[model samples]
Every structure is written in C-alpha cells, then in structure tokens.
Target: MTTIAVVGGGISGLVAAYRLRTRLGPDARIVVLEESGRFGGKLRTVPIADGPVDVGAEAFIARRPEVPALLAELGLTDQVENPSSARPLIWAGGRLHPLPAGTLMGIPATSGSLAGLVDVDTVARIDAEPSVPLHWDRGADVSVAALVGSRFGEQVVRRSVDPLLGGVYSGLADTASVRATVPALAAALDAGATSLTEAVGRALPPPSDAPVFGTLRGGYGVLLDALAAASGAEFHAHTAGASLRRSGCRWEVDPVGEVDGVIVAVPADRAATLLAEAVPAAATQAGRIPLASSVVVALALPKEAALPDNSGILVATGEDLAAKAFTLSARKWPHLGAREVTLARASFGRFGDAAIVDADDDQLITLARADLATVSGVTDQPVAAVVQRWHGGLPQYRAGHLEIVAELEAAIAGVDGLEVAGAMLHGVGVPACVQSATTAATRLLATVAG
Candidate 1:
C-alpha cells in the first residue's frame, strides 16, 4: 500500500491529505503530524458568549472560487454566510471617514475617491499624479510604501493604504511588496501603464454585486472538522521534532516511518528546517521569508450597546490608539448581528511592532476596551472577552518575495517524491492556501504515479 506523511496539520496539510486520499484511494496510508494540539493553525474559533467566534481569520474572499468550490464539494455550501451591505470606516486625523471606493486595496484610482480621507494638498497631489512621469521598471519590485508614497504622498500611504494593508498582512505598507501584496497593480504597471493612477485604474476590479467576503456560519472549526473527517488520515498531535530523509526510492519521515511521498506544509521557517537535509537549496530560500505576530481581543457586549453602523474601523498609521483595527461583528454580519450580544474584535500588533502581542491577557483586554471606547465611544463593559495571540502568525511578503518563491519552487521541483505547500509560497488567504495545497497534492501524485 502507498504511504504518505504530511508535516503540519494546518488547513494546507489537511487539504493535501484529503486530496491524496481521494486520488490514492482508501487503502493508502496517510499520516499527519502537527506540533500543536490543534489543527487549524491561524484559522481558530473559540466559544465567546453563546456562540462561536473566530479569533483568527474571520472571513475568506468569496470571489475566490477555490473556497466556494471546496465548500460545495464538502457539502458545506449551506454553511456559507455573507456580510451585510454596511461599509467600513477609516480612522484618520482623529476621526472616522468613509472607506474610499473605487480603490485597489486602498490605493485610490482617482483623487476624488479619497476626498474626505486625505488633506487638500494630498488630494491635489493625487489629482496631479498622472501628469508626473513615473519610472516603474517592467519587472522590478518595491515596497508598497515606496510605490504609493512616491506617487500619492505620505498621507495617502499612511491614511489610505496602511490601514487596509495592516488588516490583511498584519504589517505596514513600508514592509509589504507591491508585486506580492498588490499584484493587479503590478500587472498593470508591467503592461506599460503610464502612471500609478492609470495602473490603479486599470487594476481596480470591475463593479460586482457579489459579496466580497464570506465565513462559515458555524465558524472555521466546522470546516476543519469536515476536512479532518474526509481526509481519513491518522493524526498525531503535539508531535514535533520530526525530520525528513531519503530512504532509497522512498522518503523516511522520522517517527512516521517510510512513505512513498511527503509534503512539508508548515510555515516558511519550519519548512526550511524540515527540508534542510533533503533539499538544501529550497531550505535556504524558505529561510529568507520572515513572519509577523498579532493579537486579537474579542469583546461581547450587551445587545443594546450602541456602536456605529459601519462594518469595521481601520486605524491609520501614526494613530495614538493601541489597537490597529476593530471588526464590529454584530454590525458586519447579519447572522452575527441577530445574536443577543454585540460582538467586536480589536486587533493589535504589526510586523515590527509585535512586542504588544506578548502582553498578559488582562492587560491586553484592558487595552482593547480602552481603544474601543476611544474609537466608537461604546464604553459599555463587555460581558465576556477572549484574547488570542499568534506568534509568527503571518508571513511578511517583503519586496522580491515573488523571486524568492520562484527560486524555492524551482529547487523543490528538482527533487522527487517530495513537495511543499503553505501560506509562504503564493497568497496567505484561505483560498490561496487551498489552491497551493491542491496543486501540491496533484503534482506529488503525478510524480509518485510515474
């Protein structure tokens, strides 16, 4: 019987095991090794108040077909829940402003889109951005701050771009790469767009009535449970220190024994350690990627607590607030809003500013409440609160991230019966992880079959 060992029991590893099971049949032996007791990685759900609340990733991009298709295949289509039509607000200049429309990840295509958010001078600079000659090399990469700040001014980068990038990447624009973080804009630039404004205009996705994001009604735990059951793989939790080596024609994963194939699906740093002996070149490239830590404080207030109608509030860079962003759960999701409690999540920490993540639970919760009160004036004490800290939770896609991934993948391809998959390779969202795992499994299967 064919045997396979999957290192890391996160969603990527779980999905890869499930795909291998479906393709290799029930007779095959699949083993999953996770150093942590839980399997979801950053996709965690905890009990807060009377229902499940996601302290980790709260939602997935609905436009990405990978998640929707996976849900359908797993009979989880009914679990999909969409947010309300309420928009989000940007907290800048000590006030809340409407989230600018017609922007690609907060990079406005036109000056008017950012009218109320930025100052008159910044807006004027954006308006005249097209007239300024841009010197973007076709395939060169730079930080989002450098790209957007040069073209639109520092106000645009701090007030407009940083908040959105912080929410998605857990990092500031200065650390994120234009090619990796905002590929559409990079593609437009590569296609010979004359100016940054023109590139943003071309990169902005067409208007669509479809919901931009969605989440499972029962929380991500439901999906994790489903994937675990469908995979039919033996799981070993709290199982760390496993090493990989070649055993002639097969691979030997210590403690898991010999297997026909192996998948290293951990974080970039962990993947580097695992692949050090088997694929040194790949390991070297993987080690170059860095990670960021973050903390999330979920607050459950009385149903009558008065909050803004907006979905959430993003803090601009240089804000005095301790929290970076807050998702008004009760105001954002209709299903969540119907509950008896008002829920809100305050997120703290960024790429370089993650020292705050190590704070004690009580201190973090206190800071969360203080920041929440400062932003929305909803000082009602939360009846229940939950704090979750993720160390090295998100991989920072720094400039030249694409080139690093390309070299890593190229090295892995030269090896046989071995593959790697995780958030470090392509995109970091759930959809991207799913796509990466599916591709890894398919390719590994092809190699093993040959």
Candidate 2:
C-alpha cells in the first residue's frame, strides 16, 4: 500500500486524499493532518436559533466548474441551489440601487448599461470619443481598480466593481491585482481594449442558464462532511505542525512527532514556518505573501420583515458602517431556512479597514444591526446573531504575486516527496483551491511512484 500524508484538512487536502483513494485504490493508506480541532478548515456551518448559517464561504460560483462538479461526485447535486430571481442592491450614491443588466463583477462594458445605478455625467465619460489610453504593455500586472478606472472610468469602480468585488475581496478595487483577482477581464483589456465601451461590443459568452452563484442545501458543510467520508485518510484535530525538515531521501514532518511525506497546506504565514526548515527558499518566498484577518456576522431576521428578495449587498470604500460585505443567507439557498427563519449574513474586515475584527461579539452585532437597518430597510432587530473571526483569512496577492508563487513552487520542487497547496498558492476561492490540489496531488503521487 502506498502511504501518503495530507496536511491541512481544508478542501484541497481532503479532496487530494479522496481523489487519491479513488485513483490508487483503497489499499493506499492516506493520512490527513489538521491543525485545528475541526476537519473542515474554512467550510463551517453555524447554527442559529431557527436555522443554519454559513460564516465562511457562503456560496460557489456556477461558472467555475470544479466545485459544482466536485459536489455532484459527492452526490450533492440534488442539494445545489441557485441565487434568487430578485436583483441585488449596492449601497452607493447614499442609497440602494438595482444593479443594471449586462455588467458582470461591476465592470460595465457599455455606456448604456449604467442606467438606474450611475449618474449621467459618469455615463457620458464612458463614451469612446474621449477615452483615455493606459500604457500597460502586454503581460503587465496592475491593480483591478486601476484597469477599471483608467479604461472604464472611476464610476465603474465606485458604482459596480466597488459594491460587487468589495463584498467578496474586502479591499479597494485598485489594490487587488487585476491578474490575480479578475484575470479574464484583464485579458480583454490587455488584448487592446481602449475603453470598456469598445471592449464589451466584441461579444462574450451570452449569460448561460446557470445563475451567477450556488450553494449546497445544507450549507458548505455538506460538501465538507462528504469529503470527510470519501477520503479514507487518518484524521488528527488540534495538532499544530512545529517544523518540517528533509531527511536523506524521505521528508520528516515533525508536528511534535515524526512522520513521512508531509504536505503543508496551512495559511501562508503558518506554512512559512514549516517550509523554512524543510525548504528554506520556499519559506522565504511564502513569508512575502501577507495574510489579513476577517469577520462574518450572521443575522436571522423575521420572515415577515420587508427587505430585498434574497440577494445580499456589498459596501463601497469610505462607507459609514464597518461591514466589509454581506448576503441574504436564506435567499441564496432555501435549505438555510426553517418554518419562519430568515437568515442573513454580513462581513467586516478589509485592508486598512479593521472595524469589526477587533470588536467583541456584542460590539460586532451592534455595528451590523445599524448597517442592516439602514441598507436593508428592515426595522426589526435580528432574532439570532453569531459572530465568527478568522485570523489570517484574507490572502494578499499584491503586485507580482504570481512571480512569488512561481518562486515558491520552484523551491519546493527541490525537496523529495513534498508539495504545497492552499488559497495563497493559486487563486483565493473554492475553485482555485480545488484546481491547485489536483495539480499538486498528481505531481506528488507521480514522484512517489517514480
């Protein structure tokens, strides 16, 4: 039997073990090590007085194939639910406005697409006559905010991108890397888009039957529980890896004990310590990728309450409130609700914005209540509230992030029977983690077989 140790019980590690079990037969003994007491690192489903809530990743994108397909493999397809039909509102221009059609991720390719959301002056600036030219050469990495403001105009960032992406990444659009965060749009611009009005006319995929978002019936935890069952790997909770080193031919995983064939998948900061002793170069490079903290506050309101249908709202920079972003938890997936339970969630924490992360549970709820009351127009107080703090949650993919990842990948290649995988390694979302895991697992298994 081939023996392998999978570190970090997050989506990637568990998926790696599960895929390995399916591919190499059940004879192979797969051992998974998790630093925390819980198996699913980020995929957590918290319970409310009436219904369940998702404090971590609220939903997965349907356009991204990996997670949805993976869920089906775990027999979770029947459980998948799409976002509600009602439109989502962005808190901008001092009030909520219905997001216009044909604008994806807040980037409006057409001037007319700004209707209902943006003012006329902003719309006229998007016209091709006075379009400004960006000097970014091919393959040059820049900020997503810069690309949108320079090519699409500043209102595009404030009106669309700010509310849409700000809700997810929790950072200024310009600060987030164009290549790392939204590469497809960046590619279109790099292909010689003088302006968004010009670029959008080129024609892309007409929206598909699949909605923008999806969630498991039982919250993200359904997929986590399935991964636990499918991956026949030995499990350890609350065991933090001290340091890692390479022996003569085999690698030594010293998490207060010696083990072989270690896969370090913790956050970049935590991974830095293990990789430093095992592969010094990787440690040095990993440390350069900084991680920030975030907080999510789950609120369940009365079903009779008047609010937007099921879609949640995202906040812009320089907002009156401290929340990073939020969602209508029950609206995305009906499985989240009970007889009269109406669950909602909002996040706090962004670069240069740390209001809710440092606050206690009581203070956190107070901030959320005020924000929700103003934005959602709900007068009723929350029936239930839960605050979750994730230390080192946000991965900063600063400029030249890919170059650093390349350097980190190269350093680990020198070590025998060792590999790394996580959000920081590749893309930061669920799909990226799954894709990175598939790549690393194939390489590690092949190395062992050779």
Give the top-scoring candidate (lDDT): 1
Screening candidate 2 with a backbone cut-off below 3 angstroms (N, C-alpha, C), the clashing residue pairs are 145-173
Model 2: per-residue lDDT, tens digit, 1-450?
577778788888888878777776778777788888887777789778765667888777789899888987888899887776756667776777676667657776676777766677777777652356546566678776776777666777877887766665666676677777766666766788765555554434576776877877677788888888888778888877766676676666655344435667788988888777668899999999877678888888878767677477777666687775668766655566443767788788876656557899999998888888888777677888889887777677766788889999999887768889888877878888888888777778777766
Lowest-sum lDDT 10-residue window in model 1 = 240-249
Worst 10 residues of 2 by lDDT: 196-205
**Each model's TM-score?**
0.99, 0.93
Q: Deviation in angstroms for 362 in model 2?
A: 0.8
* Model 1 per-residue lDDT tens digits across residues 1-450: 999999999989999999999999999999999999899889999999989999999999999999999999899999999999999998999999999999998999999999988989999999899999999988789999999999999999999899999999899998899999999999999999999999998998989999999999999999999999999999999996379999999998989888999998999999989999999999999999999999999999999999899899999999899999999999999999988899999999999987899899999999999988888999998999999998989999999999999999999999899999989999999999999999999999998966
User: Model 1, stretches more than 4 Å misplaced?
Assistant: none
